[model samples]
Target: MLFGTSGIRGLYGKEVTAKLAAKVGNAMGGAGRKVILCSDTRQTSPILAGALAAGAMQSGAEVIDLGVGPTPLLAYATFVEKCDGAMITASHNPPEYNGIKLFSKGGEYSKAQEKKVEEAVSSDLKKAPWDKAGQKGRKDFSEDYIKFLIARVDSQAIGKRKIRVLIDAGNAAAYSIAPRLFEAAGCSVVRVNCDKPGQFTRNLEPKPSTLSESAALVVKEKCDFGIAFDGDGDRAIAIDEKGVVLPLDTQLAVFCSHMLSRDHNKKFVTTVEASLSVRETVERHGGRLFITPVGSLHVADEVKRQSAAFGGEPCGEYVFPFATPCAEGLLSAIMVAEIFAQRGPLSGASRGIKAHHMARTKYKCRADMKGEIMRKISEKPQLEGRLSTVDGLRYDFEDGWLLIRPSGTEPAIRLTAEAKSEKKLSEIVQRAGNLIMKEIESAH
Candidate 1:
């Protein structure tokens, strides 16, 4: 029943199932009059989507099925249609897992609201009268979503440049959007792992270690840039024209620099896990930075609350308020490409920016033990240096910081560290992970 940091994600058949999905749908629908339904390429998603739609109908709320596509398309449809939206996706989780993410009418959900949806499902609310049952409808908005993005950026400028780009879909929902978007931008695109839904050919997270294929393709194709998207197509990771994998934090810094330089009044939002370099980059361009807790929902909520120009995590999920309040990999790819087109070489574009080393390590732990471990860590006197429990336990020191948070979709504790040196950051993360695991073992 834990909603984790983002939504309710779990292994298929064991944790996530049709009945549970239906219950969640009924809960959301009972609370609202209209709902939008969407799903990703996972095998179990369509079945869950059907159950969700049925439950919504039973609750007397009309269901608009957005069909299979990226999570961002669903969010955009929800925002434009003014309806509560639910996307059935585990989002970067392995093939055995799936989940559901809910958004409010404007494609944003507050923490309080997320908790309410969790509560509604747990409470088993009543369904609407049989005679007043809601109906289900179908919608195809992929092309529309692509066009919406095309209109926002300088497509003409991008098209005029002869850019070679490599795109890795990671066998997720981006397969439905990435190639088309890049082609529209006039780039010679080489696609890797672009396949039908449910065919995941690589690790779904899009992290550097899992992106060797994409990097290889970028180099082999001699592309100017390479982009990779997670399962739900909400987050992205990038490789420079030289085929060097750019860490998520560095990518965020680059994107922030581009936005801040062009739009000086823009305000950017990032999580506590973001690198100090991101704040510095934004400030250098006369823009302000707002740091929120980790999680895309939190980022999106803060974006809506503060009316910020953009929001992203160091993990590569970014939301442009002007485009859509949800993270869109296709949008990020296009934006990054446009930046490279304007700035010449990717390396030159990244020059003159202060840099920091960032690393993340995760430890396997029982979900039930997270609270106890966090409580124990909070009470340890040795760990009281510049600590903030805003979203889990975040310890911020003078030169760097570390964040220990529970994985919302997995049975693991994620430790993220950022400092000036890779060796130092890795050591910090290992030390923290070791300490937390020791605590968890002792609790048992």
Candidate 2:
């Protein structure tokens, strides 16, 4: 598939290349079509983005080059400009990888739209004649985006509190904008790994394991809290004042609870991978939760369909439909700051939310074997629990649940298990892993 769960992602020169980027641009570009283009901080990003712009301009589409910026910023510009957009980024992937994410004026391309792009790449794409070729221009909307975010939240409250924040942009796309947003919200901002065009000082993904340095610095610097953003600045993981990395699922629940408290809108959306804690918290707040397949695209689409207050994934990507359809990590961090202003502290945000023990592991399986393996596993069910085939096979027990799903972006099958106790969690992981291995062995 040209597009995976996210977009066309792979190694820089292998699966992802300048040729592919140009082809994708040509596929989306046409006479009189205006396309906005941008890139992340990866060394390979500029070349790919330039190639895309070249293709788009060659096809008689006016191109606006925003240069290096976050994916959310690109999406925002696309919406305001009312044009098609493309971002050259591998998102949370390592620097060695790169990809292209497509956007329509409304939101990310839907599955049907992705299929069309794939078909276009396989067919002949014509270029505009020299006389009618499109033009390329440059623009920056950073100020506008920051102003938009400040207006979305209680800037006055945040400003009055004078919240102290430590922001780690991971030296990626949001290097300049993230700190500026926090500062605009009237917060005293301390920055780390926020330098422009610098190689990633830490892991790009904003998970607990990858954010220990930022978490420790949060307490050392006596900051109110800390925020770590992914490579493309679409994911933000918060660190408590005590230098604790808040559990992903717990963080989601706290954000949802805060949103429910502020607005009368009682609808929310999340992915199937979200913890039970999220559903419970949403229900407690008198908010309804809708679950979709794993991916920000699914959550974004569901949020729009339900007119939900917002949507998010446990991995730190959040989408406020009123703000923008793409995951807005910068906005999410500011919301965290606003929460700190309204509430007491990050440590107490999840006071009443129960923490669940979760374990995750993946097994290497060729893409071609995923279908047969899933079929075999489904045919030979060994667990006597409530089975749900929403995105994959999920069995919900009274105290926990197990999910066996094929990776949409990689050649692997993943297993996620959550239980009330660590022992149960381990048992579930082992059993699920064994079951998947057995299926693989049989398929072989």
Candidate 3:
């Protein structure tokens, strides 16, 4: 029943299972309305998705299956078809895990609505009479998705360049979508681990360590650029044509710069986890930067309310508000491609952008200790920092900041630190982790 920073995610069979997924579906309700559903290539996803669809049908909701695509594809489909949606994927969680994420008609879900869905599932509400059962159908929206992406860019410009691109799907759902999009955009694609509907060939996260194979592929293939997608394909990490991995902050700056320069007066929304440099970049370009709590949902919600041009997290989740009200890897990739086409190599384009050092350290603090740790951190008046309890406890200092929050799905706490240097970032992260551990031990 745990909902993480994204959605309901947990270790499969242990905390998440088909039966529970079905219950969640029933709670969300199909009500004879079309509901778009999709899943990644996780081993347990199809089973859990089937149960979820059954429950939705039992609740008299029609299901449109967008098979084995990213969560954003499902989100896009939900908006295109004007249907509520659900995606069965644990995103960047490990192979042993799976999850379910619900989206409203516009591919966005608020915390309040998420709670409603959770409560509905918890209550075990009954389905409508059998005579009102909903139907199920299937569709391959990948082609349409590609077409939509192509429409956003000047295809002629991209084709003229004939960019050589390397793609690492991370054995996630993007295996089917990314290569196709690149090819359709007239890029000569060099693919690695692009297999769809198979075992995860790499660590689920698309971070640098997990994407060494991608980097090697980029260098070996001499590709123009490299891209890596996480499990559900909502987040993307990029490797320059030189086979250098671009940090999230630099990537955001690139995206924001392109967006703002192309369309002035656009607002860029981000979380506190975003580098302070991003805020400076946006402001320098006559655009405003809106900071929210850490989490895509929070950013997405703010984007919708403010009609912002773009939104993203430092962790690589990028959202184009004009496209859909959710972070979309496909869309972000297309935007990156356009940036490449317009500005040449990524390395050349990323010049003059302020770069900062950041590090994330996670600790195993049981769920029971989270509250005590929060209290102890809050009581430390000597900290002399600005504190935000938005997602968890985030303390902002003059030169750095740290966020300590309980993992929504795991019995652990996530600690993120950002500063001017790696040494300082690491020092603050370790200090925060130690202090939290001490509090937990004392409480126990």
Candidate 4:
């Protein structure tokens, strides 16, 4: 079975069933003796975690269930508890969607490890003796996790700025941590939709379209900026003081530039979907940029392999190698503060990070036809430029780039192109999208 870009996420009762969760738990339990479980505010999370615990327990693995926590906290708690980690969450997905995330001490489970788990669930899984059934225990590692995260940043530097931030948690797991973290760092914290439950008062994912309310609040409250965390708190999107939601790629570029300035030779990891501005910013600061196929785990593993200090995705996933591999919103919030205190506000700090015009669009197609469509697109001899098929088909030229890839989470083909100007970007995007649509039609 194919997994999404991240984990086994879907509408809870349908695509992600309790039986499926248990089978995955049985597979995951084989990795270690003590397994730590974490979850978010989704109503189905607790139920799924229970089912997973039942499965893991029967596999002779002790379950350390940490209920209603963020994804990254689970990743960090693994070191403190000395155990492997699993999280029940569907990061940034719809409120009805739920999934599981797996992690090792170094980081998220690698592709090879995911494949192993996938194979186990597909076949009859292993089980231990009745006498050997592992026991279940509970722990809340949030406070310890908060302290550990605090040590990773320069709180003194951030406190000097005394930045006041407005956070829209979207009524998810971020509501549990972001306020406490900013307060601890000496920043005045204002909450919008923070105290609400997991039912989600707004769209779970924070995007430009979904942030009008937050943007207006930031301007009205006179905040330095605003933050909106996705449903699981593993991803975050930001808005500037002027009620302007910052462009995702430019936000990523600013951080990459700052991180590279600290250590010129350090490697920076980002997904292929990242903008040309990322490459420009990293190279301009004398740091090497390593591109990987999309997926937070993929970027995390690549960061470990390349000894990269920082990794980011255009979709707001940020990874700090020193603390943990998972993308923790609380850490990202402070890191954003530290950068502001040192460099300037995001609006000012982003001036140096020049970005090219980009056009991105998607066309719906059946999942079953994706492979055939991709194959035919690859066979096109008339297409130009150096092609990189690492994730899909990415063609690079002197002034621009075009990427056509099938969405792992949906039955659609995503096309993205970037160039120096809007006219060029639109031209490339249109041509690339038309070509892919032809393949989609031909696949039928």
**Whose TM-score is greatest here?**
2
Question: How do the residues 181-298 of candidate 3 rate in per-residue lDDT, one tens digit apiece?
Answer: 9999888888787864557878878777877778877988988899988889998888998788887888988889988877755788998777777888888888888888878888
Instruction: Write one digit per residue (lDDT tens) for candidate 4, span 238-300.
Output: 788788887889989987877876554469999888998998888877788899998788787
Q: Candidate 3 — which pairs collide?
A: 30-61, 32-60
- After superposing candidate 3, which stretches have Cα over 4 Å from the reference? 421-423
Assess every candidate by TM-score: 0.94, 0.97, 0.94, 0.94
List RMSD in Å for every model shown.
Answer: 2.1, 1.5, 1.9, 2.0
Off by over 4 Å in 4: 30-32
lDDT of 4: 0.82
Best by lDDT: 2
lDDT of each residue in 64-138, candidate 2, tens digit only: 999888889999999999988998999888888899999998489989999999998898875899999989999
* Candidate 1 weakest lDDT stretch, 10 residues: 104-113
- Which digits, one per residue and each the tens of the lDDT, describe model 1 over residues 1-444? 557776888888888889888888888886348889988888888899999989888888899998888888888888788878899999888878998888875455666877777788778556787778889988887787889988878788788887888889877887867888888778888988886667887888887789987888788888988888888888878888777788777788888888776674578899988888888888777788888888877788788888888889988888887877777777888898789878776777777667788777787888788777878877776553487878888988777888888876678878888887777777777778778888878877
